[model samples]
Target: MQEAEDLFPAPAPAPAPAPAPTPARDHSAAGHRARLRERLLTGGPDALADYELLEFLLFAGSSRADTKPAAKALIARFGSFAAVLEANPLAVQEVKGVGEAGAAALKSVSLAARRMAKGKVKGQPVLASWQALLDYLAIDMANLNRERVRVLYLNTQNRLILDEIVHDGTIDEGAIYPREVIHKALDIGASALLLVHNHPSGSPEPSRADIAITKKIMEAGRNLGITVHDHVIIGADGHVSLRAKGLI
Candidate 1:
């Protein structure tokens, strides 16, 4: 019995007393996120820098991780908070740590902004709210990489009836036909219309082609007794009104 006890070493010395549990990992990141939330609630959005605002937005997509690096990376890539919000979904997803969920969150903000701007002119006389109209158009088209031609169909009282895209691509006479503009106006029974397009070059100056196309549409609308209110060209810098410049 003594030899057996020595060989077994007295039941392995009670499994060496088991090891003590290690403390949990530090939660400094969670603490920082909580502080950010407090500041946002107490100080409002203006209290934060662009990256901080973006970080707050990123939290919706990545709740478990520190989002400062992702926010800073997005701002660095897109140049501004607005630019990031307006960026194409695929382009936005190119940023590191921005997957489908993050892209959706960013796009949701852009859509809300557009709807809010659109509300300022909807069902109202667009000419009366000309500044609001300009703001809405700029938000919709200023940052686009390609040209798009849209027509705002207005009722007899100059209230906006429908805002429709007539052509989407390079803006020229061939792409934007005078007949189509007039026909659409007649179809919608719009008494007046506004021609709008954007310049991808960031300059609001109308080229000779732009002038020629506007005149063609103006003539067609005049023949049809539909008033052409204005041809507005939007750019990243500003917008140009052809009627104000005596081009239409």
Candidate 2:
């Protein structure tokens, strides 16, 4: 008593027509990335141009997207790889195609370079390696768009025990508390302190405010048995030492 339509069942709906095979995934960028990696590994420091180096860093962020455009955009926007790295993470992301990941990658390199340069001077007598210390400071503070104060605390042996960034300020002005500067030295048992800061104006010359603060810190440290060895003002072209100029 089954109906004829029920008996036939429409021939299984013609097997639902097998879904067309998905097109093969594109591997062109992957191939290029592999070649670039090989070249980087084999070639020396000159292996890649600035943009290419940026591409290498961006690859860490994006797996499938082509990084070349991002790299080029960053270089064009920031002017150089070092400038790109020095930029604030937020600023770096202003470029098209670069997100937080890309910005972080660039920052990691910047931090690594700073640590490496610092290692050359750390644990060594900072005064004896005066040029090395200068090099480290310049690398760290030269490109800053605002003022930042770093205090290098040295034990009685004149070896660096601590390097701390104490304060950051606007493009044209900054402040550091004399009591706090001395308190940190006393707390760390540092016999001497080397103060460092950068000028956003590209000049290492000390302002009246800079001299006033340096003297105040020195006076505060004098009573506490901590010596203010120098206050170095870092700039793009050169550095000035308060002690060298007989200001402190």
Candidate 3:
């Protein structure tokens, strides 16, 4: 079968399959994240270092590069993990690699911890759960940059009813009125009061004016039949109870 020899040429060979394109960035850190999570789950809370805890926090907040560097930087800047959580959101955001979302994540943890501490006081005797109350208040007011006055109103059972900010600046300078404070308590049907204020200077010790003004508030509440439980001064150092100090 003498076909024309030149007519039929061999079919062209198929193009070689393209090799799989390589990923530009390494995903080894994801494996590290998994390991950290496992360590957290199996080794208990204290297993992870401060930097590692911070790193885990950044995972849900940031979509950038490896969070280890950010975590390390945060620890270095704030000096500790607790300090990092206690820091102001603006201050936290000022750290490189920690954006607004990351800062919010940190602050949300702080709020969650405070809420958990608060739960320890809720539905329980406030006097009996003093330490838990202190923990809650410390989380809330310890790291403030300016003095603030808050009032914790309680029912007859000594359970917290309302947490109100009565003053925003220096307690001595603020126009804190005892009549208004008593009226608020009366309006809310609160039978007791726990005065709270923060010291920016980190000293929980009460000043002379602090004692004097507290006495005034106590006297005002006394006439109104509302028991003033305690005036707790919160600071970075700790909290002080004026009643414990014999000041009110």
In order, candidate lDDTs are 0.87, 0.89, 0.85
- Show where candidate 1 strays beyond 4 Å: 1-27, 170-174
- TM-score per candidate: 0.83, 0.76, 0.80
Stretches > 4 Å off in candidate 3: 1-27, 170-175
Per-residue lDDT tens digits for candidate 2, residues 1-248, read 99999887775445567889998754799977887898899999999888988998999888878999999988888766777888899989888888999889899999999998989998899999999999899888888889999899999889999999998888976778898889989898999999999997889999999999999999989897999899999987699999999987
**Lowest lDDT 10-residue stretch of candidate 1:** 9-18
Q: Where is model 2 poorest over a 10-residue stretch in terms of lDDT?
A: 8-17
Model 2 gets an lDDT of: 0.89
Query: What value of lDDT does candidate 3 attain over all alpha carbons?
Result: 0.85
- List per-candidate RMSD values in Å: 12.5, 14.0, 10.5
lDDT per residue as tens, model 1, 1-248: 57876776654344566678997655787877887788888995587888888887888888788888889999898777877888899998888888888889989988998999999989888999999999999888888778888999999999999999987885433267889889999998999999899997889999888899888988889998999989999998999999999877
Q: Model 1 residue 53 lDDT?
A: 82
Better of 1 and 2 by TM-score: 1
lDDT score, candidate 2, position 244: 91
